[model samples]
Target: MNKVIDINADMGEGFGRYTIADDERLLDIVTSANVACGFHAGDPRIMGLTVEKALKNHVGIGAHPGFPDLIGFGRRDMSLTPLEIKTDVLYQIGALSAFVKASGGHLQHVSPHGRLGNLAVKNREYAQAIVEAVLSFDSSLIIITEPGELAVEAEKRGLKTAVQLFADRAYNDDRTLVSRKEPGAVIHNQETVLQRCLKMVLEGTVETVSGSEIEVDGNTLCVHGDTAGSVDLAKEIKATLIEAGVEVRKLEEWL
Candidate 1:
């Protein structure tokens, strides 16, 4: 059997009249979609349409929950207790789950968005809260995250987890992503992105910004759909992986 990997993109981020990214085009290329629930972005119409499109394309649907910070796009840090975080996450998941069920598709995974995602990597309290939230909602939901506290906590709670590698971002020596505010954080060059992805998948290592190699295991790779040329990048990455004899499939298949 050939090696398999999943390609996921953050989608359904538009809110009402304003839209971001070509989610339709992305749905054609990505194996899974991390849809933005109402807390951060996306409204009821966007969510329903996104779920419908994803089901039509046979792509896995995932809930992308974030802090209730629409003005900051959920990238800004928020001060909230563990219980608050858990309840917020549960609410978002429940909203998306209803849409998925209505569309005849199942929720495949849960990926915390923006700052919440960053915190989950190192904050034990936040990680545990996210894990508990997912378990309380649906224990079968796959937790998509990097190799960090979130993944560790999710696995400890007996919830399925999928390690995700970023295709368009730079990494630090510690495997955390470089802050978007920093220089050269988001890699826009297609060649550089492709090279990094191939190396990470085949070699199981990534060269950090500090010029050091670190072990990085990933079952899935993510490309931010809101970025320029995201659909093109996804297409190229999927084609390259398939050509290299790596099966590009949904995370659900592997789990």
Candidate 2:
């Protein structure tokens, strides 16, 4: 039997002063949601509403922490010490955790947003600090990260981790995502995205930009809810995975 995988999306990104990311429709199709904390794109009100929505929809909840770069929606990298990164991540997780708990919901994981996520994948120091903060805040929470780096680091640190793969992003020769600034980074074509995801989940491999196939582990798959056609893409991906007999579940269930 094919191993089950969880499908997650980044939601609750709109803030008090700014609105971005259409995520409500996409929520129904995804099993898990990573909500932004204030530092990224959410405010208290947004977080509360997001928690309620997720609970109503029976979706798994997570904290989506990122650097304090509102102008870039935490997509831009920032220079910060390891301690600073730890502090900010902890603060964000704590803030989101409150809303989830108050709503009688549990936070299932922590998926760092944007640049911080990319950094965590390669930098052991940053990964350790973030994993430590996550474990400290809630021992039960899972850390969703790339298969090799952050996931490995988190597991080594005795924190539960999920190897998360991206279905809508292109990979470089090393399996890292091609920079978004590049021309062909985000896969907007639905048919292509579907084919790529099928191969990744069923074949357990992906073709990198260098035209070489590499083995990859996909415990969970993420489709950015804020992206164009996000709702449609998520629905199609879920349908395809289910049709292939791959159980799509929340991270909590898998853990």
Point to the candidate with the largest lDDT. Answer: 1
Q: Name model 2 segments beyond 4 Å from true.
A: none
Assess each prediction's global lDDT (C-alpha) against the native. Answer: 0.93, 0.87
As a whole number from 0 to 100, the lDDT of residue 78 in candidate 2 is 83
Model 2 TM-score, 2 decimals: 0.96
Error of 2 at 135 (Å): 1.9
State in Å the error of residue 88, model 2.
0.8
lDDT of 2 at 18: 62
Candidate 1 stretches greater than 4 Å from native: none
RMSD (Å) of each candidate, 1 decimal:
0.8, 1.3
lDDT of 2 by residue, 153-231 (tens): 7888788888888999988877789998998899898998998899899998988877899888778899987788788
Tens-digit lDDT track for model 1 on 1-255? 777889999999999998999999999999999999999899999999999999999999999999999999999989899999999999999999999998888999999999999999899999999998999999999999988899899999899999999998999998899999999899999998998888888888888899999999999999988888888999999888888888899999987
Clashes of each: 0, 0
